[model samples]
Structure formats: C-alpha cells, structure tokens
Target: MRHLLAALFLALSTVAAAQQAPRIAVTDLAYEEQVARYFQYTRFQGKSSHRESERYADSDYSSRGSARSSGRTEIDYESISGDIVYIDRGELRKFTADIKGEMLKSGVYRVVQAKPYTAKDNEKLYDVIDRIKKGYFPNADYVLFGSITSVEPRRELNPIQGSDAISASLSMELVAEFSLIDTKTYEVKAAFSAMGEGQDMRLLKDPGQVAHLSRGKVMREVAQSLGVDVATQLEEQFNPGAARRARGDRYREETIERREERIIEYR
Candidate 1:
C-alpha cells in the first residue's frame, strides 16, 4: 500500500515538472546557395567577297588589266553572367525537423511549432526577426533561430604506399548558428555555433571500382548532431542549478496553494 501511494505521487510530480518546462518555438532553417551561370551566344555573319577584272584590247594598244576586290567579315558574340540563389525548402525542413526531434528528446524545453511564413515565388531568404515581429511564435516564451552557415563535401583517392591498392574517402561537413531569444523582449538569451561531419572510406585492390558515398545518411547525421549541440548548449547556458532552484520554488508554491484550495472546497 505504501509503495502504491508513493508511485502515484511520483507520477503526479513528474507531470507537474513537465508542465513547468519552458516552451520554445523553432524556426525554419535558413540557407542559401549561389550558382553562377556563364552564357555565350554566337551567330554567323553573312559576308561576301567580289573580284572583277576587265581587259580591253585595242587594235594597237598594249594590253591593260584592272582588278578590284572587296571583302567583309564579322562575328557576332555575346556573354551574360550572373549568380542565382537556390533554396531547397524540403531539405531545410528536414534539417529543422532533425533539430526539433533532438530538442524534444532531450526534454530540456517543450517544443512548439512556429507559424509558417508565406514566401513569394522569387524570395530566396527567410528573415527570423521579421517572423518574430509578426508574432509567429505567439505561444512560445522564447524563439529558437537557426541558420546554416556552410556545407562542404570532399572526395579523394590515393594510392597505397606499399601495395597495389587504392584508398578512397568522402567527407561531408555542416556548420550552423543558433540563438535563443525572448519572445517579448527580443533579447538574445543564448547564441552559439555548431558543426557536424560524416565520412565514408573504402579500399579497393582493383582500383577501378567506383566508390559509393551515402549523401543522405551523411546529411541526416550532420543534422542530428547539430540538434544535439543546440540542446546541450541551451541547457548549459541557462545553468542547471538556477533552473532547478526555479523549478523547485514554483512547484512548492503552486502545489501548496492548490492543495489548500482543495481542502477548503472539501470542507
């Protein structure tokens, strides 16, 4: 009977603790990739050459010859170059999902969905501040802003020093920055940068086999790593000691007050 009562009390306490956790809204991951294009157009120019010679013979005049020649040549050419920004909304969503999943799993903060921003067809970037100003995270106490800084992938092949084999490697790296800001005050509570990497390697005796690298797997891993880093940093920057104290004080005050009201109602 004592054990059962204890278990029941513990369950209620756990629920109360979860309810006290701060609610945070995560925004879409912002990223942009620039692709430069060089275009050239060539057209043939219609040109003609003409030559004329005339010789007139007179009964007793010496032979005379005259020649005229004219030529024209032209080549039409044009070059156009510019950079275009490529935004993959689906990929960015996946990356944000990974971070959100990690944050949820950590249980450091309750996750809330931020209202999606409507973007125009030609828009290439999402602004976090504008979203906040527009009340995108109305229910959240804080907004978590994230952006991808850089992504780099490298592949290389090398011959073994003492053997006829060859070694191949593919490496992928991703870096991102994150900030936690108060929803009302707009003050940045915590900010930091994190990086994730994945590598695939293989050795072949024939040296002719194609090395296959898993890009999706690498990207997923990188995203998950970034999520973990974000969550861990949030916890550390807030200071666990202060958080625990705040939780304890709130729990005591709220629970005791509720209990007193219950007793009065029963009487």
Candidate 2:
C-alpha cells in the first residue's frame, strides 16, 4: 500500500515538473543579404559626322575640278549607375535546426515548432511579431526570435615558407542576435548576440593542382558552435546576475560591435 502511494506521488511530481518548464517556440533565423550592384553600359552612339567639299577651278587652258573630300567620325559613350538590391533568403534552416536541437538537449525549455505566417500576397514573413499575431506559434508562452546579423567568408592562398607548395585557407564567420520575448506582455526577456567562426587549411603539393576547400565542413562547424553559444547564453541570461558577472561578457560585447555595421542611410 505504501509503495503504491509513493509511486503515485512520484508520478504526480514528474507531471508537475514537466508542466513547469517554459514552452518556447523557436522560429527560423531571419537573414537578409543586401547586394549593391554597380553597372556600366557602353552604348554605340550610331552618330557619324561627315564633312564634304568640292572645289572647281577654271584656268586659261582648261577647267580643273577636284572631287569631293569626305571625312567621318564615330563617338561612343559610357553610362554608369548603381542600384541597391535586397535579397530575401527566406529562412536559414540549418542554423535554426541546430539551435533548436541544442535547446532541446539542454532540457531547460520545452521547444516548439513555429510555423510561417503565409501572407495573402504570398510574401514571406520574417518578423516574429507578425507570426505571433497570425497564430503561427500556438500555445507558446514565449517566442525565441533569431536573426542573422552578418555572415562573412574569406579565402586566401599564399606560398608556404621554405617550401614550393602553396597554402590555401578558407574561413567562415557567422553572427546572430537572439531575443526571448513574453507572448502575453510582448516584452523582451533576454537579448544577446552570438558568433561562430570556423576555418580550414590545406597544402597544395602539386603546383598545378586545384585546391578545394571544405566549405560545407566549415559552415557546419560554425553552425554547431553558434548553436552551443546561443543555448549557453540563453541559460545564462535567464539566471539573475549570471550574464553581468560572467567573464565572457566583455568579449561577447566586443564581438557584437565588430560584427554589426550600418551600410545604408536614408534621408
């Protein structure tokens, strides 16, 4: 009888604990790549300037005439202009997948899938506010909003010292900002920026050999690291005074500043 009572209490306790976990709806990471293009087009003017003249002279013996002399010139002009372009890379699923997995693994929060808000015009909605209002994340207590602040990839090739082989390296960096917002109050509970970077290098033995860098590997590494970073920060920010007292705060702040830059200005 006592065993049955204890088992009932234990089951109830487990149920209560499960219900106490915060339910979070994590949306895919939003990213927008702005591409500014400068173009120059050379147009053939199809214009020709011609000069023609004829001279005739009459002398005592006979009349002498000179034929017409003609000259032509062609001109071409160049037109240069630029345009600001925006590319909407709907949702970065790779990063979001990793982040959601990490959060789930942590067991701190109950992670839920957030659906996309399908607008009537078929335009994609990247904003969390619109998604929440449209009932994308149903029954979620809070929404985890993420956006890609910046992504940079670099490649370099240089001669190795004291060797005939060339060293080729490829590196990728990703920065994203995350915010946990209360669904009812629409207040931001925690907000922070996270970054991840990865690199790969290889030595080319043959001079004419093509060096292929493992771009996918590098990006996967970045995504994994970014996921861990986001989960760690989320946990830290939720704890009172944890983020402020953390030793990595200064470094994170500096990274956040370096990764974000304003390129467009509107008057």
Candidate 3:
C-alpha cells in the first residue's frame, strides 16, 4: 500500500511539472568561423584583371614611297573583384546574440537571455552542459547550443546591354547544427539541423554591389526562420511522449511484456 501511494504521488508531481512552460536558453551561433568556412569553398576566377595598351611611333617617310606613322598612345584597364563574398568585414558580432533575440520573437519557448558569453567556436557539448549545471540561467531547463556549419552563397550577373546596366541575383543557403541539452541530466535531448535559404536581387552599374547590400538582408531573414525551426524542434523533443499520452495510449498501459508475442488479453 505504501509503495502504491508513493508511486501515485510521484506520477502526479510529474504531470504537474510537465504542464509548465519550459525555459530554454539559446546560445549564440559562431559567426566568424562560419564565414571563414564558407570562404574555403569559394573558387575565384583566374586572370581576373584585363589590360590593353597601344603605342605608335612617328617615322618620317624615307627615300622610299612609305607613309609616316603618327604618334599615338592608348591604354585600358578592367579589374573585377575576385570571387570574394563581400559582407560587412566589421567585428562579427556573435551570431548567437542575434539569433537568440530572433528565437524569442517566435514566442514558442520561454526564452531567457544571459549576459553575453565569451564562449568561442571551439565550445563543446560538455562545456555547455557544465555552464547550465553551474546555474548560468537558474530558471532554464534546457540550453540550446548551435553553430553555423556551412554556408553557400550563389550570385548571378546578367548585363542588360541596352542601358549599360546589370541585373544581379544573389542567394544564400545556410546549414546549422543545434543541440538541446537537459540541465539536470546533462543529456543531449535533441540534435537538430536545418537548412534555410534567402535570396535578393538588384539592378546596378556593378553586379557586385548586389551582393554587398543583399547579403546582410538575406542572412538576417534566414536567421529568423532558422530560429523558429529550432524552437519548434526542441519543443517536440521536450515532449516526446506527450502525443501518445494525450491519446490515452500510455494511460492504459499495463505491465511490460514481450510485445512481439504478447497480445492484450483484456482490452
């Protein structure tokens, strides 16, 4: 009888706790490392510069029936910026800082913000778990760790010959890895990876200008979408058995038995 009462009390406590909103802390995504990683895949075109020169020397017609050449000098130069993806080269604020605010806008998780952390790109899962265990966010039940693993930006330029103008189209694809770690148990409850793409185009004298203006817009927009997806995935992970329990499937379960052979005799 005592064991039965104890089991009932524990089950009620679990149900009560599960009803509360979960506190989630999302760390910053490493921005600098991701940008450097993308540079590795960028292939630059060779002989990116073009130069032309023409020179003619004046020569008097000798005693032959030859004409004299006139003096002339001409020069031309063209330089194309190598396949460099020009983003604001300023101090790369932690992607984590920006992403955390974006995640909060989703209003899906009870997101908590902490003082900016100095954790670098090399921060590991164990290190994150330790921070949470040390009461980094006292109310947080889970800490989300994320980093940008890959980014690919594609740019297309088409010159409209009529008006001396160029049309530029830019697209960026980003892939990131996110982990949700439980504070108490220090177990990675979920690992979620998602790819998001953003695109923008512009018509300007220089095709390269399109990317300069559009890169920030695309990445900023992608970050918002990325935040929502991560939050939704973590919510599902935190409630793995909620769907089954809600359907009255788990509530009716009896003693565990070999499911392959045993059938419920008294359903």
Output the number of the TM-score-best candidate: 1
lDDT of 3: 0.60
- For every candidate in turn, the CA RMSD to the true structure comes to 6.8, 16.8, 17.1
Task: Report the C-alpha lDDT of model 2 over 1-267, residue by residue, as the tens digit.
Answer: 345544555565446546666899988787776667666655657666677788899989999888776778778776766775756555677777778888878766788878764455324455567677778889898998888898899999999889899999999999998899888888898999999888889999888999889988898889889889998999888643333334344544454444443212321
Error of 2 at 162 (Å): 2.9
Worst 10 residues of 3 by lDDT: 252-261
| lDDT agreement of model 1 with the native | 0.72
Q: What is the RMSD, in Å, between candidate 2 and the native fold over all Cα?
A: 16.8
TM-score of 1: 0.67
Across residues 212-245, which tens digit of lDDT does each residue of candidate 1 receive?
7777777777777777787788777853334665
Better structure of 1 and 2 per TM-score? 1
Better of 1 and 2 by lDDT: 2
lDDT string, candidate 3, 89-186, tens digits: 12224345545665555444467764345455334323676667556656787787776777899888878978878878888887888888888888
Pairs clashing within candidate 2: none
Would you list the clashing residue pairs of candidate 1?
none
Displacement of residue 100 (Cα, Å) in model 1 is: 1.5
Model 1, stretches more than 4 Å misplaced? 1-12, 33-35, 39-91, 121-126, 239-242, 245-267
